[model samples]
Target chain A: MTGSAQPRQPEAGVRYDVFHTDCPARDVVDHVTSRWGVWVLISLRSNDLRFYELRESIQGISEKMLAQTLRALVQDGLVWREVEPATPPQVTYGLTEFGRDIGEPLTELFDRITQRLSPRNAG
Target chain B: MTGSAQPRQPEAGVRYDVFHTDCPARDVVDHVTSRWGVWVLISLRSNDLRFYELRESIQGISEKMLAQTLRALVQDGLVWREVEPATPPQVTYGLTEFGRDIGEPLTELFDRITQRLSPRNAG
Candidate 1:
């Protein structure tokens, strides 16, 4: 692994090193793996959800934080937002194709933790 | 989805809910996905690494944080610590069988982000 903090060149336009420190990919990981990011993505599943539905799904999350999490996911291109014209404009969020690609692996990782390796069983 | 904040019972001694907020699995997720946890696990990459080697591989991490991170992994059973009987009792850290199970999916999720979903390409 290279030690330099310079931005890494993508491998055939296909990869970046998260270890490089200067890679934008590292930033993306940091954001997605943030405290609420994974929860939001995994909570989304295959269905688009209104903000309140998402808030209710992931208990103890404040509306401010939920909105922030959705915003970051959208900016990462892993999620999309839509506004429904109703009595009150309803904003909904769902995983984009790219989101599902990454979310698939994230879900797998989560299952590994909650299923096979948590303290109760792995011990 | 259950909105109750009670500790979730594992399914057939194998599953726990991370979204329930009261599940121990949630705390584990919060720890493992912290700024350095995923990096450390992915950095191990099927090899035993001396403390300094790990620090070197992951640029910009301080010794205190690395030590703390290793301690957590060791306690979680995802990493094992070995003291090589030597002049200074050299130490090494490596993943346990369980760590490998979880690390596999984490690495896949990471690869998805860097390889297929980074802004430069996902756009």
Candidate 2:
């Protein structure tokens, strides 16, 4: 077989083939876009927030659910957790560079969707 | 209340406040980014496909789930379902202008996430 006829290797660092079930990117997408995940990311867009602050800002999210969502984002490297050394330890969550890179687009999308569905536009 | 001090009325067409549970745009976001919804939108980004074709393209999606996802997107005005008058009554689905508008960004985000999660980049 000619060199040109050989099958090309899957491009490196591109794991987003939706057709492939084993693609790790699918999990990332699921996590970031999950019910609570979207809210968490958007909440952090403007500023870093403490855990309670996040819960307060995102109405209706349970403490357990918020914790789980934050953990998932942290694992995905999209969020950073900072712990303050104090009598009562404090933790604040902020988007990492990677998180911001993705979060910006998501926030824009969220805004657009909301704009489209508003009462004035619901014709 | 002074004229300048008056609270401005909610702008004409803006519906995406995640903080409010009754916000219509939240439902739009949920449906579009849902487990199967994301795949369906991404799949149709390049080309329109029939029901069966969509089922095949998005691995692991059940007929019930696909139907539900398509229905939600259609209701949200992001997907167009066209039925062909043929022996078997072919049905195809494609993105509406609105769908494309949102799909473009979603697809971009999906690509970015996949790129970041690929094994080669998994440092």
Candidate 3:
């Protein structure tokens, strides 16, 4: 077989291909755009948080889901999971540089969304 | 009796309050920030689309979910649904001016997200 493989087109007429089921981009989108993912990134923006703290910051997120979500984000390189060798198995989580950069815009978007719906300023 | 009901506190530290289960913002977030909601808004950014057309544009979204999401968005004033009095129930769905304005920023966010994760451009 010749070493040339045909390339597939990106979906939705955008250069991004998250719409495809087999695309790795789908996983990234899931990690970054999920309901908890959105707030998790927002909560981690300005500070480092432990696993439980992250769960606390994002209200109503179950521990199992939070751990799973964080694991995926860490694998995707948007989140860093640090485990300090301590008696209590201390683990802290924070955003990577890429996460920080990407998160700023996302947080801004969230801010705009909230502001638009604010009762005091509702349109 | 003098009416003096104290205002309830919004959830989380942010000025916006989707973190609360009871807040109406949760419903708005569910509709606007959902997996399908993200793409739906992006799809409507540049054009008006009919109900079926929207379903076709967003891959993998179930028709029931899309109908419900669109209905909620319309109620929230983020989308405009027009039902023409005609045969076969010709219904058109499009963004309101408010939707258009909100969608611009959201589309921009999706663009950045896709760009950041592009295989050739992966960090």
Candidate 4:
């Protein structure tokens, strides 16, 4: 895990180190835990959604930020974008298997934070 | 959960809404999940550490960012800061009960992401 500068070798039992500046995990962590990323993942955990539906569910996110966050998640392969062929083609977003794996913990984290900060729990 | 502009009343069981712009939970989420905050929490989860020790453990964090993140965490009551009276004095940071509660989920999230992004798992 120390200074080998070569690409990660998972087959050799090398672990991806997030503390390393060049690790790909850093990028994934940034995208997944990002402001909009957290909410988007949480929203999609229960159901797939259209762009506008996600926007409405998230309350105050701007359309641009939502679009950007979705794109990033899709690129990272944590989200899948499906386009249906129809008169008015439909575009929907859902978490991929990997996305769901990551999303579960994030959802739990969100619930915990919300619970801790809830009015009843606030001290 | 809909448009109520009044300050939160915890005794009434009103959950703090992260989706709402004015919710205090939103602020806490922004601080705790901020780029540096996640790593900081994960680093401190195993054991308490001094400011310099944290910076060292986290690899690439800047001094200003670390200081800011710690201050925000402390303000949110998730982290406890203890200063010992010595020749130069010593300051150590550790998770408060609430901080550990949140940190566990975050640590899980981090491990999951790292495992997913590892070269062996990357697809």
- Give per-residue CA lDDT, model 2, range B36-71, as digits (tens): 888899999999999999999998899999999999
Give the per-residue lDDT digits (tens) of candidate 4, residues A3-112: 56655465554346787777778889989888788889988999999988999989789999999999999999999999999879988999999999998888788789
Task: Go through the candidates in order and give the C-alpha RMSD of each one to the true structure.
Answer: 5.6, 4.2, 5.5, 4.3
- Docking band of candidate 1: acceptable
| Candidate 2 Cα errors over 4 Å, as ranges | A1-16, A120-123, B1-16, B119-123
Q: Which digits, one per residue and each the tens of the lDDT, describe model 2 over residues A1-123?
A: 233442343554443576657666777888988988989998999999999999999878999999999999999999999999987889999999989989877977876787676554555
lDDT of 2: 0.83
Q: For this target, which candidate reaches the highest lDDT against the unseen true structure?
A: 4
**Candidate 3 Cα deviation (angstroms), residue B118:** 1.7
Off by over 4 Å in 3: A1-15, B1-16
Q: Which regions in candidate 1 have their CA more than 4 angstroms from the true location?
A: A1-15, A117-123, B1-15, B117-123
How well is each residue in A1-123 modelled by candidate 3, as lDDT tens digits? Answer: 343343543343334465655556666766777877877888899899988888777778899999988988899889999999999998999999878876876776766667667755552
TM-score of each: 0.82, 0.85, 0.82, 0.85
DockQ of each: 0.44, 0.46, 0.34, 0.53
Extract clashing residue pairs from model 3: none
Residue pairs with backbone atoms closer than 3 Å in model 1 (clashes): none
Q: Which window of ten consecutive residues has the lowest lDDT sum in model 1 chain B?
A: B6-15
The superposed Cα distance between candidate 2 and the true structure at residue B37, in angstroms, equals 0.9
Each candidate's fnat: 0.65, 0.55, 0.28, 0.76
Q: Cα miss at A67, model 3 (Å)?
A: 0.7
Q: Which wins on lDDT, candidate 3 or candidate 4?
A: 4
